[model samples]
Target: MSLSALLFPSDAMAQQSGIKRIDLQRHDLSVFGYETVQARIDFEPGTAFGMHSHPGEEVIYVLEGLLECKFQ
Candidate 1:
């Protein structure tokens, strides 16, 4: 599997009724040694994220299926 495929799989579906969410990253958040948080998002497919950038840093990763990102 390509890196993209490994990081992000196919489309995602919303939680069915009575089924609880069990995403580790969502349920168990990562602790960053910072007081003022800037940005943090956990996305399933169909979840939306706007374009982003920062001071010489452009970081992107997938916590779940195919976090389709576009910036311009």
Candidate 2:
């Protein structure tokens, strides 16, 4: 598994909550029988991501604020 950090915000956040996203880098790699993708999703947030999911596996780290997540 790989871990990553992001500050992605919702569309409404950009206009209403003063959020922004800065994509620093993105790439895909395959090794043996595994595939991996690396990306950066930077944002300035004044709101929270309501509901979301990603393909395969995901790891996230937050720099500030609080995160409430529900998985089913």
Candidate 3:
């Protein structure tokens, strides 16, 4: 799957849920079959994303507000 597909909600869902995603950069890694993706995601108050997982490592930095995360 594409990076956007893995990291973002569907367009219709995002519109309905007041979520916005801005892709900052995407680059292929030196290792074959690996890549890195950077993005800025904004969520309106009370908005929440569904459960999902990524293929590679993920790093998140929240600019402001409370963010709750769950992991298995």
Candidate 4:
């Protein structure tokens, strides 16, 4: 399964939680069986996501507001 499928919430969940995701770009790497995806996610005030895992490397950048994260 794709990383987005693993990490991104379903449409119903997103609508209920006031979360929006915009996929910016996707590309297949020159190396065999490798790919990269970039996306932007927006969350409403007081909204949060449950603990989740990604299938590959993940990076996050916050354009505004403070973000709290927990890792285990």
Winner by TM-score: 3
Rank ordering of all candidates by TM-score, starting from the highest: 3, 4, 2, 1
lDDT, model 3: 0.64
TM-score of 4: 0.69
Residue 7, candidate 4: C-alpha displacement in angstroms: 7.8
Per-residue lDDT of model 4, residues 1-72, tens digit only: 012322343455456656777777778878788677676677777877777665566666777786776877
Q: State the local distance difference test value for candidate 4.
A: 0.62
lDDT of 3 by residue, 1-72 (tens): 012322443355446556777777778989898778676777778886677665677666777787776877
Residue by residue across 23-55, what tens digits does model 1's lDDT show?
A: 222122244531222223344445453343443
- Model 1 segments beyond 4 Å from truth? 1-40
lDDT of 3 at 9: 36
Where does candidate 4 clash, by residue pair?
A: none
Which stretches in model 3 have alpha-carbon errors above 4 Å? 1-16
Model 2 lDDT at residue 30: 62
**Each model's Cα RMSD:** 10.0, 6.3, 5.7, 5.9
Q: Could you tell me every candidate's TM-score relative to the true structure?
A: 0.33, 0.47, 0.74, 0.69
Residue-wise C-alpha lDDT for candidate 2, range 25-68, written one tens digit per residue: 44454645434443343344444445655445655765555555
Best prediction by lDDT: 3
Candidate 1: residue pairs that collide: 8-66
Error of 4 at 16 (Å): 4.9
